[model samples]
Target: MNNNNALLIIDMQQEDGFVLEHFDSTVNNIAALLDTARQQRVPVIYTRHINQADGSDMPRGEPRAADGGPSSYRAGTRQVEILERLAPRADELIVDKGRYSAFHRTDLDARLKALRVETLIVSGVLTDVCVLSSVLDAFALGYHVRLVSDACTTTTLAGHYSSLLIMANWVYALEILTCAQCLHALCDRAYVSLAPQQPDQFAHQPHELENTIARLHSHLVRTQE
Candidate 1:
């Protein structure tokens, strides 16, 4: 990953915002990556889900319409608050986005461009929806996209896995990596210490990783040749 890359933490808000069973698991890893991003002085941008009628702040029929209703966490609602685990610090940019793509109707691209960011590291919930939509847009907008597989979750396992398959199989230059791999790449270290939700959540460490990055190297190697 280049130093000019920015880490985009998409829509990881309160429980109502994410609505996933394994929400904590995803948040934990995203926070871990954010930690590395901070330590490395990488530009970090947090995208908040907005709504029109309390759903998403961008009103319906507007240029930037979001598919889902205004999540309770959007804007003034408590639901819009970034989960404490991966909350942004004062220096980071908090982008308000009504659409799936952060660049749609938002100044995300401009902000990144101003920072001279050429690559984007993406993580968030609803793997097949918001995450995929934003990543595809990032790719088209000329940013190298890297999806943090373990740091993103969906309401269903099938949808989550399916998105990963599609991203890995077809999206050229869009890489799928585990939170660990990404963290290490940013930190330039071999061992990454995860910021778990609780001290007892150790069991989730490797188990959660196995499904995200373990197979990516082999897949990438084959695709490269």
Candidate 2:
């Protein structure tokens, strides 16, 4: 795994009205990715969407209930907390925002730069909303993005699939893969853990080892170039 890669888990919170399809499977896949990231010593970043207690930070002209009550994700409320199953470690970065994109009015870009994160492994809820927004912004900022298909879901299957297709085809050259594929790619790059026992056998063709490493790294990052 590249040392400059980071895992971004966006808005996996406990909001009441935000029901995702295949919630259990998505969470499990996210958890697996989280474990792999930690094992590879990659930075893990989490994003939470929270608004003001009085709904002052909510988007203006948003639709309201028949009673004219505003719908908001209040800060410090249980609804805004990250889901317990994929809780971030104390050492991980947790960025709170009031907008759909994690970079909007937030320090996510700076934080990722500080960690020297050249690639972002993205997974989270609402594939067509926050995930799509964040991925677009990340691409704009020149970060190679990998979207874990099984680790993300939306309220509707159509939304999820449509968003993935748009991202893969038009918005960006995103490397979309399953949790197992991602894990295997990460493990393959960890040379210390997966090194061959017979080092002397391949010493005559050192270029072969170099080429293998380069190919695997390229496969993982999937740069547009």
The 10-residue segment with the lowest total lDDT in model 1? 193-202
Q: Estimate each model's TM-score.
A: 0.75, 0.79
* Candidate 1 lDDT by residue in tens digits, 1-225: 345778999888774733575777788888888888887889889987766554435455644325454434445677777888777889889998777777888988888888899878889877888888888788778888878777888987657766766566555657666776787668765532222233232122445645554344345334322
Clashes of each: 10, 0
Top candidate when judged by lDDT against the true structure: 2
lDDT of 2: 0.77
Report, for every candidate in turn, its global Cα lDDT versus the true structure. Answer: 0.71, 0.77
Model 2: residues with Cα > 4 Å off, grouped in runs: 63-72, 189-225
Error of 2 at 33 (Å): 0.5
- Residue 44 in candidate 2, Cα distance off native in Å: 0.4
Q: Give stretches of model 1 more than 4 Å off.
A: 15-18, 54-74, 189-225
